[model samples]
Target: MKPSTGRQKALAKALTALIPLAPFSDAEAIREAAGQRKLRELPPSIAVWIATVAHVRHEHSDYDALLDEGYDRDSARHFVIDQMNAVLTTWRATRLVEGDEDEGE
Candidate 1:
């Protein structure tokens, strides 16, 4: 899958802002702090996780949707990290296909 685009960022920001006004504008900041990417494709689980974080900060309708979908706290957390790793690996594979070699490999 392609990396999350600027449109995604804007939508995420708008949705997050409506949720409850997170202390931060970009949730990716938190992901990066967790050693994740700032902008990349995410699995549904991770997307839920990111949305959950925003929701926990401010439970809006969208967040409610995630909860309604049966996302538990543990799952949400795990999903974020797992999704990040998955995205990174996929990105690396894509780079390889594009003729980009791994550094020193």
Candidate 2:
């Protein structure tokens, strides 16, 4: 519906860089521990974000829900981080497919 903004592009580049850091190893740790479970290779779609629905929709974070339901704490965090990364990935993907429609020569 809209073109990807500069911010979105920059963020995509950043997340794309972090793709190599998936499943963080002991040598490269995140917030809690070094040897925790690795994250998904692709970003998690935590919520059902419709590209053509009322501009935006409210979707709850699956990660938080998991945390509340006594799920694996580390895994929940990993998914949350993945989802954040997904925002950028999503932007890039959407743009590569449809982002140019809004642009003018």
Candidate 3:
């Protein structure tokens, strides 16, 4: 595998910092950090991992909805991740077709 580049490393570092915040947010920083394209620029898996962890930690509706649908917490998490992956794949494919290598700003 290729070595991680500076931006890739930065992405990792950002996640390291952001993750501890999980369910809490400071408005300005939260807006700024999330507004930065870096979050979206991270590899989809990593991005989804962060989102899932945060959502699960906060017990967001997405996670709860699975429980409402009869999935146990463990099963719900797996189900959400699988669904996220499918959607992410479709989004990437759509971006490729649009010829905009960047997913978006």
Estimated TM-score for each candidate: 0.23, 0.25, 0.31
TM-score, prediction 2: 0.25
Q: lDDT: which is higher, 1 or 2?
A: 1
Superposition error at 22 for model 1 (Å): 1.9
From the highest lDDT down, the ranking of the candidates is: 3, 1, 2
RMSD in Å for model 3: 12.4
Task: Pick the lDDT winner.
Answer: 3
Candidate 3: residue pairs that collide? none
Report the lDDT tens digits of candidate 1 across residue range 5-87.
66455445443433333344334443332223442355433443454344332322233444567997444444344343333
Better of 2 and 3 by lDDT: 3
What would the per-residue lDDT of candidate 3 be over residues 1-105, giving only the tens digit for each residue? 121665545544544343433323422233334334656666543553444334332333265777788988766555565454444343232211122212222
Q: Which ten contiguous residues of candidate 3 have the minimum total lDDT?
A: 93-102
RMSD of 2: 16.1
Each prediction's RMSD over C-alphas, in Å, is 15.0, 16.1, 12.4
Model 2 C-alpha lDDT per residue in residues 14-37, reported as the tens digit of each score: 333433233323112221121113
**In order, how many clashes per candidate?**
0, 1, 0
How high is the CA lDDT of each candidate model?
Answer: 0.37, 0.31, 0.42
1 or 3, which is superior by lDDT? Answer: 3
What lDDT score is found at residue 53 in candidate 2? Answer: 13
